[model samples]
Target chain A: MEQHMSEIVTAAFIVIGDEILSGRTKDKNIGHIADILTSVGVDLKEVRIVSDDEDAIIDAVNALRARYTYVFTSGGIGPTHDDITADSISKAFDLPCEHDVAAIELLRDYYKGRDIEFNEARQRMARMPKGATHIANPISIAPGFRIGNVHVMAGVPSIFRAMLDNVLPTLETGAKLISTTTPCPFGEGIISTPLGQIQKDNPEAIIGSYPKLAESGNFMTDIVVRARSEEVLERTTGAVRALVARLLTEQDTGQ
Target chain B: MEQHMSEIVTAAFIVIGDEILSGRTKDKNIGHIADILTSVGVDLKEVRIVSDDEDAIIDAVNALRARYTYVFTSGGIGPTHDDITADSISKAFDLPCEHDVAAIELLRDYYKGRDIEFNEARQRMARMPKGATHIANPISIAPGFRIGNVHVMAGVPSIFRAMLDNVLPTLETGAKLISTTTPCPFGEGIISTPLGQIQKDNPEAIIGSYPKLAESGNFMTDIVVRARSEEVLERTTGAVRALVARLLTEQDTGQ
Candidate 1:
């Protein structure tokens, strides 16, 4: 596959559940997803946490899938009433959902050795949108689905993470990453103006400053610069270094 | 201040940075903040990740502060050029940016014995939104701000965590949490329908299903029920147990 040069593969995460919005569950999926996507060079642009409402899910799914190269949704796929993600997605794409034979066979094989009964409720897991492919869940027989560019996975952190790992290797990835950082004993404001100038100078590189609160109630800031190309990252980092040096000198001069 | 009986406190998180959007840095702020707020009974309804663009910051700040009982922002408050959160917040609130005497004095006191220069760059940390109070950064002299209901804090995990500890005690919290869980050897689909029925029957109790992926590639789902009152939580949990038992029995009979 010939990859496009300007192809900045972007993805958005939609976390659905009332528990997360209600503050009953602190989400672990975002961090895990973000890290996994980063390692593979896919930029995670936005994350939205919405409730279990069907309209909300449909709206979010539509918006995100339109805006980004891919959309990944976690939660709301179960045998329960609230697990309406599959129905919502089917509605969004105008596709009919029926139990898939391949998925059901996999589920059957999974339960063959165990004493567990594969009931009607359990069979619901085999349902998938027409033309959708299964993202194998090595941990569970109930597979996640990939419909078009959207990957729908379980909400539980462990399962979502496992499903993600299973899915990532199949996707096309572009560049490797290069990053540099410099720590300063100053707050953010002192360097904001200059950093903005550097950013303008090197639009190819991404620059960020993180202000930290020290144990003694003082601020320490770290300026990080990153790029896909190593040479560009080095050049940008050199500029950052000079800027930091000048800022330190200005601090010494009391200006 | 008269607190309304049915009052619900809500919060929104503003994560400002290009780093997170570019996927170079995985954010730790949102998860920590969500956990802290949930523990204190505050609902975290929305989270927005915006770039260091001044207009973006100002817009998000205005919109979030208006909708939520409290708005907390992490990142973009440092001594560097990209750190524009304070100035942006000040502009959003239509407040003047000026060096706060108390904050400056604190910074001076903090750097007294250290070899660090309290120069123009460091002094920038003292600038606060006019009429706003400071949230003490016990870890750093550059204090975060609280203008109206918005709380601005550091982005570093350690510092943000510390500052949150200080700020949390001052906020009013409602209703202690009561929760119980039961483990089931089924995938989410099997339990979804019954879980929905259970939730419909017990509207006040919040029921959630978390599917765990085992090392052997099987699913273990834990159904958790939560409520503000212990009696309600207990009742909901009993219903959940009965539902799970009935479902399992039905599955056995079908097999």
Candidate 2:
């Protein structure tokens, strides 16, 4: 229902962790989430990495949920004291956070044969906002919950990926974007003006220029064009290729 | 002036690029910036990665600049159509963006003997918010600028690093946080209760539990304690280590 007839589906990502902000952990989840969203034709509009503070979590969740089609959050859902994402999400939605009967039953059964005890701390993982649906975690028995437009998942990369795999199939996706990248040996300085013209002319396609440093430290620009329609993508890339060819000819002929 | 007598200088980082959001480029700048900020005693409170759009850039810059002591931005300063960060920052601060005389001079001199032309597009790199001071880029002659507390830098990792090096010493810094980590053999479920107690006892320290996936797919937790005072850090880490030891003993006794 979030997606209408339009070919645009957008999502925002929230990374909640003190370890990431403290420089103790390098985030591997953002790129994985971006790649997964892109694969499903979801445009990742913005990403915010906030520390594991309750106020910060609540503020981000509320703000992003109202803006994007879906807001995905990772980290701070564990049994540890610092894990406050679930509670914060509940507070953000004005829902009563309590133990979910199904989650408690699942965790109890999961730990029945295990050596670890089903203690109070472990039970904390079962708590969720009322009216929330479970996003099953294949790697871990404790599930991530989906309340409103926000999908809360575990911080562990493997667990995040597993939860996303389960959640992606259910969300509305846009038309897959068609893209082409043309590599130009010239610097961005040489191609930027014409590239801007191409972008202005082809408003349907999203044109971007990325500069990379070669092994020899010379600048090389890659022109990437993306569109929902194959015809538009082809036309835009053709114009870009023609421009690059003309620039190369001028360089070679000393024009 | 921003630090005053407080020992808590904070910053927010904004990453401006579409390549990063499209999954075509995995961001190397966030972690590098986080590490650099931590080393300089600035707590990196938040990080937002937005696409190369004018409104997105302006919003992120304005919101973060108001909240944090410093706002550092990377990307969208190159000589390309997609490079709109400089203009966005100017608009965010309501400053008139004009060509910086020193930047134009430096770029012109740098391109004097070079093969690349110092065209209008190349000169676009010299534009900055009025009254902004340059943040030197040693690798590339084009400079990043610091307007008020916001520092704008390039997206290329090397160039970003060089610009940050030039900017870091000029900012106000906080007291360095002292930290210690203890590896826990038990899962977070086993350690969470006592870890919570340890955290409650040490109100001054920031305690965090991170879960890692071992080669055998089992969860391993690392208990980290951080504080501005070395004494508090030591005391908190000692309590965490003792809790781990007690849990290990309980497991061995099967009690």
Candidate 3:
């Protein structure tokens, strides 16, 4: 494993849509982006799902962009009246939004031969914040944009993925987080005490126990150990393995 | 269908777990809770997903609780070292968490002769912040709690649903939102111009367009108009239905 990093690059996702809040649409973009960010060594610290309301978008974009190293937004950049993310983003940064020539050119080329006309609505996709750089969208001709730390993209999963592929390579990478998972066919109650001790001993690593209810009405916990440092990761994972093993052995001999 | 004169209630959800951030688990609670909240007249304003980190939970809780009328938290109320949401939430309110006699009694009665022992770890579920009232859990004997406007519930979907059923009846209900979704065969680009005009004409209603790209590589947009007042909802939906009819007629005649 590589040596632990000096700083862990963190990111926040602002999912912009009204369909999501209305529960009409199940969000497919968050987990997709989270997987991409994790594989590229960026810690996705927070995610917020907000409606298409302009004030809500402005508030969330400003808050997340200021806090995390990168702020990735999904949805609301399409060519519709309700698609107001780009304008709201401009409001967040207190800048004017205008039609960009590069984006307009891409749209014109894509729509020249297509059924969807390059009308004012499709032209709306070319509107981006002033002084913002475009994030390429191969899936859709309409380009996403990057202003400051925020990367604004389309709501559709394919377009969001394409934009991410374009933006990920340009950002700085951090030390990758390493993890090990062990299934504990035991109740969380049985391991809480010793698990707390393990947590105390390995402060650098994050230990999490997730409890799932079984068919027979028992708690099944999966313990995961995560750390940026290899030594810490191994040591903590070793300790967790030993503890679960000991408990298993004890139950085998007695119960 | 009632007059929209009163205030609109809002809620923000904090989903606590490492599984979500790791992309190992697809979240089921957000949509479930969003649906429930919307049904009960409360607007689900935002949702944040955070890991089991203490500072992250604390910060999210504080921010959401302050911004929205209610803050609902799911996860981390189990019997393990990683189940630290109860403690973290207590810290958010600057209160000490202790096992409530009511919860302990309920658990004790339920587990008196059960296979899983009612041990110290199980006792951990009884812990709640000072001056908090317990929210009953029907699936499990353990209960969730409410401190101020923050409602702390289980991470498990079944348990979370049960707790929500108990909590919903106690909350103040607002005017239910009315919605009508119009399936527009025309592309979003084709309708974007007039849709903006319709949006302006119906400022009381929220107009949303969700475009679905088909296997045939065509854009299908579902436009939803939502409002609290029945009159406004009807008027806005009528305008949308008329506009879509006009567009469809134009396409049929190739005008």
The top-ranked prediction according to lDDT is 2
> By lDDT, is 1 or 3 better?
3
Q: Write the per-residue lDDT of candidate 3 for residues A1-255, one digit (tens) a residue.
A: 232377788899999887888788889988888888788788888899988889989888888888889899999888888888889999999999999989999898888756445778888899999999999887667899999999998888888888889898788878988889989877677888899899999999988887778887767778889898899999999999999999988753110
Which predicted model would earn the best DockQ? Answer: 2
Worst 10 residues of 1 chain A by lDDT: A1-10
Alpha-carbon runs more than 4 Å astray in model 3: A1-5, A252-255, B1-5, B115-117, B252-255
TM-score of chain B of each: 0.91, 0.95, 0.94
Ranking by DockQ: 2, 3, 1
List model 1 lDDT by residue over A147-222, tens digit each. Answer: 9889999887777888998888777665745578888776564566678788899999888776665665555667
Sorted by TM-score (best first), the order is 2, 3, 1
Q: Given the true complex, what DockQ would model 2 score?
A: 0.65
Cα deviation at A209, candidate 2, in Å, is: 0.7
Question: Pairs clashing in candidate 2?
Answer: none
Docking quality tier of model 1: acceptable
* C-alpha lDDT (0 to 100) for residue B109 of candidate 2: 83
In order, candidate lDDTs are: 0.78, 0.89, 0.85
TM-score of every candidate: 0.81, 0.97, 0.94
By lDDT rank, best first, the candidates go 2, 3, 1
Residue by residue across A1-255, what tens digits does model 2's lDDT show? 244436688999999998898788999999998888887789999999999989999988888899998999999999989999989999999999999999999998888756557889989999999999999988878999999889999999889999999998789988777699999887888888999999999999999988888877678888999998889999999999999999888863110
Model 3 residue A77 distance off true place after TM-score fit, in angstroms:
0.8
